[model samples]
Target chain A: MGIRQVANTEAPALTAAVDVRDLWMAYRPDEWVLKGVNLRVPKGQLWVVMGPSGAGKTTLMKVLAGLLPFQRGTVEVMGFRLRGDLTPPSRRVVGYIPQQLGLVRGLTALENVLLGSLARHGGLGPTLGFFPRSEVTRAREYLEMLGLGDKAETRVFQLSGGERQRVAIARTLMQDPKLILADEFVSDLDLPRAARILETIRGLVRERGLTLVMNLHEIQLVQELADHVVVLKDGKIVYHGPAGTLEWSSFRALVEAEDGRTGVAGW
Target chain B: MAEPGSLAGKGRDVNLRRWQGLSGALALLAALGWVLGRMGFFEPGRLTGGLVNFGRFAAELFPPDLSVLPVVLGALIETVEMAFAGTFLGFLLSFPLGVLGTRTLFPRPVVLAVRLVVAVTRTVPSLLWAVIMVIVVGLGPLAGTLALAVYTVGYLAKLYAEILEGVDPEVIEAVRGLGARRHHLVRYVLWPESANTVLSQLLFMLEYNIRSSTVLGLVGAGGIGFYMQVYISTLAYSRLATVLLAVLVVVVVMDVLSAWARRHYLLDT
Candidate 1:
């Protein structure tokens, strides 16, 4: 595989929305999930992280989202340097969509979206279900933007898988975050729906000047949506470059060689 | 030597275990029989005498004295009020205690400390608690209500802890990631997710407290049981019968009402 490094000399470290240096994470002693990882995402760019199952894809996203505390690393997201502790940085800057979507199934779609804005409104009002009217309106606007305005009052468990995915996206957007870490966000959707959602997400990222690091198994979507791509294998990056110049055939072989089976077959 | 796959070695071990289990069961049976003999459970003379006394008592219980109906009804109302007030007070305290006792929410030391308090409180029956409260606070409905509330806190807090612990961890993690504090989690995620179960348990506790509070008055804690004590001491079996009948009807009614409320409002039909 030909690995071409994308050099953005014009965009310095100051422009990096996400920067990770020599990150190492382990759930237990000496059993590392992420090892010596380094990543830098420039402002207003969509980056896709692709790897085979259990290749530390989700782990990397968890560390970036400040959900998982790494043993050793420097993770700086939206100018907040993460301490090696359980205390996550400010919720206003980073929004994370886990693989399960991390939604409260009992909550309404609108209420779930409103959760994103709770950090902004301190004290007991938000905790007691009294969100400010302006924030509530903003949540509705996010839902409307994601085409879930009609289903705002519906419970998350009642919504369809695609609709739920859209709700997750809308909720993340409701946080008004400068950085988004979405792990397998569209993996549940069909190709067409995934494409539509990705397009919408890309448009939003561009318009809002947000930086996104999304983990995906769909090579086609990765090819289409990624401004840059970082291919991880066994807790380390094997390839990092522009999405346009990524050799798809070689990339597939590199990830699928160990399983000896094709995933998301040829296109 | 028996071959690795051969049943000879395994069969011998299995036979030995079976014999050990048989001996254990036989020993347990022998112990139970000895305890029963020691307790005079096998004495036919004592058993017949007890039955004869019970028959006479049963005969006296008939033709219940209706003259005390108004007085019994007033005492019954006091019993019901005591149960309500006690259970409400317990419900108030249980939320915080439950949160502290929840293993998922609190640290090991906090959970252990809260659990220890709950276990100690639950170890004493509500009747015993009423006796203590009566001595401490003087005889009244206040003593009975306080006793019931303390016992309710112990029982309900343990249950609430279990419910809080059983909430979906993923949802909690998600909310925590959104920079939610511990209290925020209880209010938004844990409470909403487990509301139905928690409410149903509360109603069941109320029902149980009602039954318990009826007996608290025997110890001068103020309820229908106080009247029961008076009649029993005076050998007024008919009057005792009236109080017993009233208690039975109220208990049955409460059971039905609680069941209906749980079904109609708390549970998902």
Candidate 2:
């Protein structure tokens, strides 16, 4: 297995940053959550998905990120097949942060950020509190970029909600991922903090020229950060076009229509 | 927004709640009475009283022989060691199996296989485990230690599964996003979050194991129970008083320690 993997990696063209076709997922047999979700985002493109609650917006991200197994679909991320009609641990190329931001509370910002990179490249990083200097330096740099340099050593549980979100984004960056999948990361933040988070994400997208497919409620955020906007409703794309065409009214209508179905449009 | 009709509906809901609560209280009292009746609780009370016999027994235990205090101390220490060794064995062994038994950690078949093994062990009482060990090891503290260790693993495995299941998956998602390996997840995320609850349970189990070891000794498993049995069988009321006092002191200390640990780790204020 090691020899074959090594031989295959010599030719990097074997991987695509993000690829999906005919993706279908239904937690229950009675209904499909994501009906034929066909999507493709090459390296360095920011794609934002907009939809009301239960429209399979978050489901699409998870399926593409290889977090959820689609009943019938093919997902290839960064040349690694996340789920090609089957589930596998395809976290090699993609960094996925879900809506709740599953950050470790006991760890510091630096440790968390360092952990992200260690997972991908493979190394015996840290056992106890002791850490190597090089990794610690990299972790501090990532936190500094997120405007959290002073708070790098601070435990995550001690941080504010906004600070945690920034640290989460920083941790994702630590992977040096070709693609980032954020599922409604800004829904928990206030309007100003949400704007800051979007700016932080946009800077990362621009700097790395990476593909970012995020599921978010704020259409305004998409207009600001996304290159393309895909709106889904009832497991189907109702609107797919440039972010320039989106307006408050159409997005609001989708929200009002599905008001009773789910509590919020944010994943 | 709900309409005025919903508010009127809420009035009906309040009435329904009242009726349910009243009926539930009556049902509980009746069930208790029925169970007590089945147990023949009242029949024993109707029989002749033994107030005088009780007084004599109470007198016999008191003015206890303080001469055997050293012997009592040694037995008490053995009981503590038994509890310590048992809890340590249980905690360490159950840790990995608990992680395996968690559906969120391992695959379904893997979890099921481990669960079957745990269920078999849990079905038997700790005292039975002691008896089995006694047969093999032959009358010693080693038998009591083995029994409680097995008992601890069974009890902790079940509890650990529930605690692992109840862990904040959000934290898991955080580390997984960074692409932490399974071992990484366990060390960084699982160990920290579950440590408090697990510690509290360990302390409680330690207290229980100490008490259990004393009882297990009655069956030739070993520990202070042999002395207790001797006192009982020989009618050595004075030595029995010494043994009882030693057991009581140890139990009180264990309870106090358990409470202190809970307050320190759990309430965290």
Candidate 3:
């Protein structure tokens, strides 16, 4: 069966791809990183989570990706309820892009992308570094989509920062995830490259009806690309509204005020 | 006489500090020398006598008897076979133990248990293991093979566990995030990433086993070392010289082969 068919069968009919309610997380006792975060991300739209450094944006992304365990929360991703432990089925439908890009430096772009189909190929084939011809073609196509067709055989370490990010995106795309969680996805790119990467991701989301939850630092890019914006401050959601309606100056003021109070500064 | 504020006074002060430091170092060295002397080190009589005996032994080893070439070759082959079989067997057995011993992949208890077994095995030297194996399996290559295999398992298992644990956490996390099971994580990410180091370690173990197996015969476990011990007891210096030459050639050959394998396989990766 195709990966999308399997994903569709696993995920029941739900309007919201991600449904997080009363989420509270802490890396240590007595220090809460995310405080009662409630979010409802509808399918097939780009939602950006923006905040200053240490505002728990990356923490929330990790929680959604099932990498971090929360103290108290109900996280539903791709219709599967994540209650501390993430099931294999839920993981198959959620793609995570970490801030470091998460690409193996020694592996070529094509080889890294081929790793995304590991779950679909039943583990053994991919483990042996063998991908079926169809999967190989699809991997190439994903690389091409991310504008890395020419550099498929290039080792990831040899690629520039922006190129490496594109390779990461291609790898994520190859997973055929129903929902994608990207942390600082374009933070390494130049203005034009960032715009291009975001446009490509936005196009793919619209075309494939994939849910995108991204943590972005660029205010202008967030405004330009985000369908909805959720502003976090001091482990709490300060604003959750449409990106177009939110004023940049007010959002910056709220972030700066929190930064001054905590002696932590970031745009 | 120079004024206190003059450059000459400063130079005198520097010289004074240097002299003090030099004297302190000299005193420390003298103390260490006295301690070493107390420990029976660097005795001129024994040192000169030992050097003279060593030179006589070296002179006797020259003009080695090539007449025993056939017997020496056979025993050398036996030693090589023992090392090969032992290393291969140990490598096969170490796989599961190494996987289980990895702290990142398995639970704490499982890792601890596996590591405990590895540590216990590692504590026993290969030659000591050969002595025990000689009692269990009787004399010959069988005992040597068994001893080497056991020792290799202990060493390689710990080495492999360390290599697996040293893999990039980011790569592992990425794979795990993609719904990879434990086996999948090991087979795809861990093994491929650490293949070069693993291969290099394996080659090193094989080389070590070869050198070790040659000595296993010293305990009647079978190899050129058995013949060497017999020759020494019998005062047959010529045959002992021949045996040592054979061992030197075999070790050199093994080293070359191992270096080639490491370069070809590991460097390419």
Candidate 4:
């Protein structure tokens, strides 16, 4: 299928959907979590961030999503430059799916998806539970697109893990985001399900020309789905290029390499 | 090569240690008994004498004077109204305080200030509050209602803050990531998730307030308790028995209703 570009007034004519330059972050004082990390992701591409356990893949995603504050460096996402603080206005064009699939267990799938348009319906609309019929219809359409039309009335607690993940994706899609950051969004799903989810994500990204950056541990899945690949090790970028450019053996070696040895345990 | 006498000596040492432990326990028990006796807790003479007098009074309480049934029912209805009004007011006031007190929503200083107010209010019992209100508001159901409302605000707010704090952080994180404001976080995420728990706690507080409101009138706060005091002072055992029976019936009905509400409405089951 040819790439379909939807004109967005919010996003400028910028090629890079995400651009990070020498980013640095730390949870504690002096000790850094991300040290001198840099990346540039073009629009309409599915990028995979591959790393071992505690290799700062999630941290980088948070920094890009404007969830975590950085001690140093610049981050530009969805045409907004982020220094440290993540203001609500700057976050409007982004959709973030956390590792745990943060769907409210008590709310139905439709209600959960409707929460994505909360910001759009500002004032007392959300507080009074008054959603315009158009927004509700759009939410249902997103669920239908995600193959959850029949399960719209089902509470999230009653859904399986894979189903919950799909619900989370539908919720994100309802946001109408320019960039989507997913952290291990399908790690719990089986191979066929994972492949199907990736396929759906790929189709959406291409159809809408939305940038997709996700953290994945499965190398074969990454090889099949990722248009671009970034490998992080000890808070540094070990590899960043087109996914097809690297051999499987070399990519494995790059991920397993231990460069910095401080005898510190993985976070 | 060990001597037989050495093993026997070890056994003797064990026996001595066991005896020491037993004596230590005995000393502790004796100390506890001496303290309790000094506090006048084990006075069998006064207890037996009081029981004999109470048995005489109990015989007089039978065949309760049905003549005062109407008056007793009116006071009983007033008591239920006080409990219901107090619990409703408390619930209304506690809702905002609970939301503001959550550390996830507010800063540490703000959360701490809200918690300090809740703690101070909760430190005083509802009966004590009624007494204080009686002094301030002066002898009526108004005093009882105000007392219960203040007391409920303290307890319910603390309970709500705890529930808000215990909510899964990831759920909040997801909402916040979507650019949801503070109010949205509360209205959409926190309240819906904790609604069942909050409803259950409210019902429990209502049941407890009903029982407590019955006694608020002893301080002239207005209820059957004032009539009870009057009957006892005038040595009117039959009237007092009628009042006690009315209270028993009201409390039982409230208990059953609250339990039903909890099971059928608040809980999933």
The interface root-mean-square deviation of each model, in the order shown, is 1.9, 2.3, 2.1, 1.7
lDDT of 4 by residue, A23-88 (tens): 989999988879998888878888998878888999999888877888988777866777677554
Q: Which clashing pairs does model 1 show? A: none
Model 4's alpha-carbon lDDT is 0.86
Off by over 4 Å in 4: A1-14, A244-252, A260-267, B1-35, B43-54, B267-269
Question: At residue A38, what lDDT does model 4 achieve?
Answer: 82
lDDT score at residue A115, model 1, on the 0-100 scale: 86
> Residue B231: error of model 1 in Å?
2.1
Give the C-alpha miss distance for residue B32 in model 3, angstroms. 8.0
lDDT of 2 by residue, B136-243 (tens): 888888989989999998989888987887778877755765666777778778877787787888888999988888887789887888889999999998889888
Instruction: Single out the weakest 10-residue window by summed lDDT for candidate 2 chain B.
Output: B42-51
Q: What's the DockQ for every one of the candidates? A: 0.47, 0.47, 0.41, 0.49
TM-score of each: 0.86, 0.87, 0.85, 0.87
Model 3 misses residue B45 by how many Å? 1.5
Residue A228, candidate 1: how far off, in angstroms? 3.5
lDDT of 1 by residue, A89-155 (tens): 5457888988888888778999999888777776889877899999899989989888988999998
Query: Candidate 4 lDDT, tens digit per residue, B53-134?
Result: 9999999898899899999898888899999999999999998899989998899999999999999999999889999999
True contacts kept of 3: 0.49
TM-score of chain B of 1: 0.89
Mark the regions of model 2 whose C-alpha exceeds 4 Å error after superposition. A1-17, A85-90, A121-133, A253-267, B1-28, B44-52, B263-269
